[model samples]
Target: MGAPVEIRGLSYAYGSGDLARPVLREVGLAVGPGEIVLLTGPSGSGKTTLLTLIGALRAMQAGSCRVLGQELAGAKEAQRVLLRRRIGFIFQQHNLLGFLTARQNVAMALELDPGTDEAGRLARAGRMLEAVGLGDRTESKPAQLSGGQRQRVAVARALAGDPGLILADEPTAALDRQSGGEVVRLLRELAKQRGVPILLVTHDPRILDIADRIVAMEDGRILPTEKAEPAPAA
Candidate 1:
């Protein structure tokens, strides 16, 4: 298979005319399967913008961006939906339904994949939660779980689909150092064992050691080194 994500001369701007503000400028990067690339940059450096573009959550504007070999620039909604099925995302917010148990929260991810039977989805969800050290809390509601545990549930949900690529934005920012460390370890193991590419946007230096490569960004452009420590993507 080709690289899970490839971008060349990609650029993006917000608004139009007088309000147009560039968020990404000629960003070029490629992520090979089984590798974890950490993207670190100050706020508004286009890190999240790039992730959103690659995730097909937003319409692509300039240059070329290919995920799993499908060109995404100006892709239609159906095409974007088709492409997104093969990708997983873990964002800062868990976004779990309060009424759902952890297991149910994770199993719901299978809704996107109609091929998976209910039994199979639960089985896979259980295994994934176990992988992230949340096996014992499978039936707990979001309110019953700790911040770290909830995030792990989010991780399990994102990975249960056997996605080919993972895009994590500040996956560890809300957790303590130890919890953050565990999350990164789980992510690293998943990327390596499944041969899935990961592009994580994080300012957490604690997990930087887990990355195979580090790409810095600044002012909507990738930089040689991070210019300043910026807050999590807004």
Candidate 2:
């Protein structure tokens, strides 16, 4: 079976003051395993909102969202927390703790999973950082790393748990053009190598070439992109 994502008539809105100000409406899409999907739109187009919903960071007010066979729409808070642990997330800000070293940040995710021994956890964290080109900087804190390096550390942190899916929100926004391209490439390569589906939310057009599919959102609605056959390896 493929690592399929099925979203059906998804809808969401912020604030209870007025229902007219919905952020997402009737959004629907699917991505198979190893697919790199780009979610692009203008500002306030609900790109981030959609990514959050898919990642189980926000409650689904309507419709259904299923990732790796887990339904999120009606899941309880505890269940949502459990679901999130299985998925990797990279935010635009590289939200790393300033006090923690790169290796520590990655290892933190492994700690969330039960029965992970200390040696195995650290080894996995080290491998993830190494994969993102941060092998020697494992001990470096976030403040010590450059913008690109920090973002790479964030990528390493996200991949530490061997998540089945990765949701990245403008992960390359903080880097220079060259560095941004490298980060995007790294994300695509990791998704392919791990057979994990990647949903990247961004307005930048530079990295669209790396995406196997592109879904455009505007005014809280998702427009379908051309469907391609699932990559054989994923």
Q: Give the TM-score of candidate 2.
A: 0.92
Q: Least lDDT summed over 10 consecutive residues: which range in candidate 1?
A: 225-234
| Weakest ten-residue segment in model 2 by summed lDDT | 225-234
Report clash pairs, candidate 1. Answer: none
lDDT tens string, model 1, 1-234? 668888999999999899999899998888888878899978878899999999999999899999998999878999999988888899988889999999999999898777888888888899998988888999999999988889899999888888989999999998998888878888888777788888999999888778878899899887774333322221
Candidate with best lDDT:
1
Compared with the true structure, the alpha-carbon lDDT of candidate 2 equals 0.86
Best by TM-score: 1
